[model samples]
Target: MQTQIKKWGNSAVVRLPATMLAQLNLSVGSPVDLKTEGDRLVIEPSLNREYKLSDLLEGITPDNLHESIDWGEAVGREVAA
Candidate 1:
């Protein structure tokens, strides 16, 4: 597919078709990496991965559990539980 570069404020922008974005699993506000290789512009998705809280908690076990530290008596109007 051929696309033309258009002026967007002070930057040049190229609009990708919805079909192309859907095929690449990209959406609005998705992060992408852009580079130039031998006069060719390469656009690719960023490598950053999003992690879920439940998935992260699954890695913790009794073997690697840590004990809470004991802080001394609180000063300066601190509430005691």
Candidate 2:
């Protein structure tokens, strides 16, 4: 689809069609990366790293673990038992 670039405030903007946006699963406020390759402009969804639980727990062992803290008693206000 062809879109004309129009001036919006101090920047030039090209509106993407609803169909294109749907195909790309992009919505308003979605982050996008833009770059110019030679004379061509490339637009893509910004990459976000989604870390796995295993990866986050990597290298974590009991040897490096700290003892759990215990709140001895409810010194402040206490609710019904």
Candidate 3:
């Protein structure tokens, strides 16, 4: 399928067909990664990962909740207790 590259303000824009977009599960405001492979333009979903609260705290339990760290004395302007 051929598409036209139209002028958008000062840059060129190629609008993807609705069918193609639907096939890729992409809708308006979806993030995508674009790159040039040799002479081809490749578009892929962004690698940005989204996690739920449960996913982030899965391995954290009460046993490790209050684990202390030996972060040596603050060298900067820190208020000493």
| Top candidate, metric TM-score | 1
Q: Report the backbone clash tally of model 2.
A: 0
Question: Candidate 3 residues 2-81, lDDT tens each?
Answer: 88889999999889988988998988778999899999998897877898999879979898787788889798878656
Q: Please give, for residues 34-64, the per-residue lDDT of candidate 2 as tens digits.
A: 9999999999999997989999789689899
lDDT, candidates in the order shown: 0.94, 0.90, 0.88
TM-score of each: 0.59, 0.58, 0.55
lDDT ranking, best first = 1, 2, 3
Error of 1 at 38 (Å): 0.5
Candidate 3 achieves a global lDDT of 0.88
lDDT of 2: 0.90
Model 2 spans with C-alpha error above 4 angstroms: 49-81
Model 1 C-alpha lDDT per residue in residues 1-81, reported as the tens digit of each score: 999999999999999999999999999898999999999999999998899999989999999888989888788678756
Off by over 4 Å in 3: 49-81
Worst 10 residues of 2 by lDDT: 71-80
